[model samples]
Target: MSAGKGLFVSFEGIDGSGKSTQARLLAEALRADGREVVLTREPGGSPGAEEIRALVLQGDPERWSAETELLLFTAARRDHLERTIQPALACGATVICDRFADSTRMYQGLSRGDLRRAVDTLHDLMIGVEPDLTILIDMDPAAALSRAKARATAEERFEDFGIGLQEKMRAGFLALAEEFATRFAVIDGNRAPEAVAEDVLAALKARA
Candidate 1:
């Protein structure tokens, strides 16, 4: 779909790199700066997407094959874009989303190598939008995994993949950032939340 006038920023990283927290902080910071900001997340940003989120995130890890899970994620993303993200941008609101399509690429592509082609193809065919800027919170997988497990939520399907998979996911994200250098900012996430937030803002300012 076509992009709207406002800025679209997405936060991505391994499961517990604190990307979500950073997204929230960035949104608050931007709003305080007098910008209209919309804070949202993927897999459940909008009403219809939230339903899909439950089916994907709350079930057993084996509930769907890699390809099947990719389709489900694409469907939820379609709804999320149409209902929440696109509309907010159309209205000139900066949209800060936690976990956009990159999560799908890293998780599905790295987990099931063959599905990487399918992920890219389906994304181009059905969801042809990319974030204006993507903030990758790069960090150590072991530390991130510890944080993820400590949260102990029902949506632990991805987190249950353990430290090894998290390591792979981290590498995938870094590779993605390299591939899309113009639209990505890789931030060191092994720091205090406030420090990370400051770095994030600095990165955005530099980009601007």
Candidate 2:
């Protein structure tokens, strides 16, 4: 870890678990505190990564196999790190990412199959960057799905995995968080947005 490096914080959850909102609030709060902040999301940050993110979330992913999807995510992460995250961190700008390596591990590694192998492969293949902190906005899978459906946005292939599978994905994320307790903050996402934002701010304050 670079002691002089910018703080690397990741916000993770199912599609409608309020992660993005919390990340935004936290970024704004960090800025208000006179800290430089870079707020970005995974699967996309730079132009090229945005294209890849679109491919992963909005396209006919049936064109690609599960193995292919995992590899592509890792590729996107590598570019994101090399081109965006690394430089910002080197300059000491705290980076608050909407999602990061853990998302892939939950969506693909645990939900899909071969969890252990996927973790190993991604670590070996990517630049091996992990977040300094990961906040998991925890909520019931059914509630999260309902919120997601209300948004009426284009669904990612992962979101279409059905409620049953999504429940498993939730469990997967929780288990993964458990494995890295020191780096995780599991907050109740079912709460009001302002309350949730406060929770996120508290976590950031603790870390900061």
Candidate 3:
């Protein structure tokens, strides 16, 4: 199932679910074991994609409609795949992505509208690759939202949608884990970061 010699792993969850921290932890662990790790993020993994990221993540929630967001995200992802993800995997480096298409599936596909079909079609047509393994950090929407708001980053557009969006996203992500069960490892994110990292590492080892 690996697209290349290296393993491709993606972390997915609602905002503030600690998936990003876990992605970094796993990358460090892999490197400590002598594996070459390429840790990156969606919507901004490559130069062009990063430019798109600013547009999509910094504006008002209503700035871009769900349909527009879908197109923008897909474009960023295409660039990310071509300039960052594929090349890393082709060279036998473990590619640890913070967020991948599943985020699009939940946010753009189900958030404002039922654009799942469009998301899938574009994915198949422009970006056919899937992560060899996906780690989903699961947690309560309320708690996760609080953590997310605490960050107060410029990319708070998504967070601005409030707990309602987080609630919906959490449920959608859980459903997604079931839909893609074969490649997913659902880990609880309610514990301390180190504890969560332990589970994340364990999931990776289990997948291996």
Question: Best candidate, TM-score-wise?
Answer: 3
For candidate 3, the per-residue lDDT at 59 reads 75
TM-score of every candidate:
0.97, 0.93, 0.98
lDDT of 1 by residue, 57-145 (tens): 88677878888889899999999998998889899888899999888998887775567788989999988899988999999999999
Instruction: Give residue 73's lDDT in candidate 3 (0 to 100).
Output: 95
lDDT for each residue of candidate 2 in 12-77, tens digit (9 for 90 to 100): 998788898899988988899899999999889877788788878875636566677788778888
lDDT (0 to 1) per candidate: 0.90, 0.83, 0.93
Model 2 CA lDDT for position 36: 93
Better of 2 and 3 by lDDT: 3
Candidate 2's C-alpha runs over 4 A off are 2-4
> In candidate 1, residue 77 scores what lDDT?
95
Runs of candidate 1 exceeding 4 Å displacement: none
In TM-score terms, candidate 3 sits at: 0.98
Winner by lDDT between candidate 2 and candidate 1: 1
**42 Cα displacement, candidate 3 (Å):** 0.9
RMSD of each: 1.3, 1.7, 0.7
